[model samples]
Target: MPHVIVKMYPGSSEEQKEKIAQEITNVIIKHTGKPEEAISIAIAEVTEDLWIQEVYDKEISPNKESLYKKPGY
Candidate 1:
């Protein structure tokens, strides 16, 4: 069994996340000789404030809102 964890800013579409999970599972199954059902994929959506990075003492926020027209429901 293979486990994969993906963490990103909280603005990805459901379709996008599903596609990514499927693709990742497929790749893991192909390379690791594991069954598709044996591969596990998890996605973690973090808030924009939590996804910040500091550059030269300046806080840089990731533009997660631009990923979709409507983010959270």
Candidate 2:
């Protein structure tokens, strides 16, 4: 089972989130051959004020070796 967590600045609509999840699920299914039911997606809303400490420093910077696409900012 592959679970995806998308963390970003909060502002996206519910429909946008749903579309994002669906698109990700489709890509996962297409590439990994995993069934849609086996995949789970979560979107965490992080404010700009706390982004550096809450996400970038904790997750991205520390885990750069494992990242497929690195953030520019």
Candidate 3:
């Protein structure tokens, strides 16, 4: 099972989110040869004020394994 998580600021419309998820599912299907029905996508809208503490510190600073590519690393 491939679960995709999109973390960003909250502002996009529901239609936009739907489009994003559909696009992501297409990519996953092409790359991983997984069926669309087998893939899952979740969007995590994080407030800019807490991005550093919630994502950077916990996910990035903790050895940088969770992050594939970032600006300064």
* Candidate with maximal lDDT: 2
Q: Give one digit per residue, the lDDT tens place, for model 3 in 1-73.
A: 8998889889999999999999999999999998889999999999999998998787768866655776483
Ranking by TM-score: 2, 3, 1
> lDDT by residue for model 1 over 1-73, one digit each (tens)?
7787677777889999999999988888787889987888999886667554432113223454454433342
RMSD of each: 9.5, 0.6, 1.7
Superior by lDDT: candidate 1 or candidate 2: 2
Which residues of candidate 1, in runs, are more than 4 Å off?
A: 52-73
Instruction: Locate the minimum summed-lDDT window of 10 residues in model 1.
Output: 52-61
Top candidate on TM-score is 2
Q: What is the lDDT of every predicted structure here? A: 0.70, 0.96, 0.88
Clash pairs (backbone) in predicted model 2 = none
Clashes of each: 0, 0, 0
Tell me each candidate's TM-score: 0.65, 0.96, 0.86
Candidate 3 local lDDT, residue 64 = 67
Candidate 1 yields a Cα-based lDDT of 0.70
Where is the poorest 10-residue window by lDDT in model 2?
1-10
